[model samples]
Target: MSDEELSSYLPHQGDRIRLRVHVRKEEETPRTKKNKLLTVLQEKLEAARKKKTTSKEEHNLEDMRNPHRPFGNRNAAKQNRMIEIGWIHKSNQRSTQIRKNKGGGTRKTEIPRHATKVEIIQQAIGLFFPNGLSSKGPLTNFNFDLWDFADREIDANVTVADMYERTKLPILRFYLATSQKTNDIGNTTDA
Candidate 1:
């Protein structure tokens, strides 16, 4: 029988088509998949951006209706405080002395202003714990509770040592005498 006659007798149209053809199919690589994903993401992002721009007027109207939204001015107070603190200078010797008496230095001396923050902190730490950092004998225990109290009063999120560096507060130096003590005591004791 001819091929046509045989094909016509088949039950289904697909089964009648017996011719086979070979075609090369390319496999998708990771790089190609990644590029496709990136393109899709970019398209989605552009759509979102356009949507946001189109709705901006609506958002503006809402903001106008409720000018004093709690979320709108969340950082306003903190920003103002930061600005106020930034305006403060280390040259205010009288203020520094007062702060020093309170056990918190908030300014640096003119010469120490050029020093690094770490240096200032180390100096303050040395002054506060003269016997804690040394390698000698007869270590003396000093109370750091005053420094903590001063830090809280300053309310600048800065360490007592750092306050001394910035304000050149003489009170910090009063507590910073050089001692002939050893670190062994400090290492063994928990503060």
Candidate 2:
């Protein structure tokens, strides 16, 4: 008997026939097109940027028009400024151990404009020396000093507001000078 004749008598006779399938392509909407989508997104971003800038400008204008208004009183706002403090040896070399123990890199503190160098040092001590200073510790007989970017030591009496007035920068960067101690062998070491 021929295969076809035998297949027609089998229980799975439909297996002998091959089926053809067709797939339909989905239609693209106006916004689904790449160029159209990008254009729409760009327009939205531009509009948002313009709105934000205009609102800021309008707020500034309002503040200027009524400087004494309690609703927008600048004096009532906190005049805190950001300060970055890092530890460095008196030789100006960065201390890896100190940096690693101090959570790596410079520590930032937000202080009011009227804060003094002494206050900043206290804050720095809290950040780097959690247990506070001790006579038995490495910082014994050592006092930290604040140094500016120019490597000049800042006076303890100077206020942050004065520094800001001179530099006109919102954030100030400074280094805490590590004290050097001489061992019995006459070798200098960083405390």
Candidate 3:
């Protein structure tokens, strides 16, 4: 091809080819709690810088926002306060008649942090014993108690937060047990 034909095929850079560019400007202020926390931290960081404090314990806003960082996001504190728990159907010689009343499979639930063992047992009774603890059938002579995974009887006064603090486990498993009520002579009675 001749130079004249090549020049016609390729246009010069001086041609009027117009293009539009768009830019977006976000609002300068942030109103959320996280942003407020970041602002506070930034202020503290600035103050520390002015004082020439050591950089070993100092963390930037990005580090504070990271979930993987244990000390910054408040997850550890929240995690230590709550626990997921479930109930299992446990049977003994006295509870054999009520064996068929085992409601369903273990359904794990997150109970309130301040819930006590008695409250948990009541809630579990509602779930595991839908027919109610009637005074006519197998429930007549027996009372229900909650037992932990280690087969230890749980105290009714302890809270779920206390259990979480003591066990330090995210999930705590418990079982329902029936104990026969006694009369004046400490002997089991069916009255």
- Deviation from native of the Cα of residue 188 in model 3, angstroms: 7.2
Lowest summed lDDT over 10 consecutive residues: which window, candidate 2? 18-27
Stretches > 4 Å off in candidate 2: 1-67, 70-77, 91-98, 101-104, 133-137, 181-191
Q: Candidate 1 — worst ten consecutive residues by lDDT sum?
A: 80-89
Tens digits of per-residue lDDT, candidate 3, 39-79, equal: 99999999988666545335465576785765743633563
lDDT of 1 by residue, 1-191 (tens): 55577567765656555432111122333447888899899999999999998799788888899987656445332211111010111121321222344333443322232333334445555433345542222234322212222332233245434555466544442222222222665442322
Which lDDT tens digits does candidate 2 get at residues 165-185?
687675787776656666789
Per-candidate Cα lDDT values, in order, are 0.40, 0.66, 0.59
**In angstroms, what RMSD does candidate 2 have relative to the true structure?**
14.8
Q: Report the number of backbone clashes for model 1.
A: 9
Tell me how candidate 3 scores on lDDT. 0.59
The 10 consecutive residues of candidate 3 with the worst lDDT sum are: 16-25
Task: List the candidate numbers ranked by TM-score, top first.
Answer: 2, 3, 1
Off by over 4 Å in 1: 1-35, 63-96, 100-191
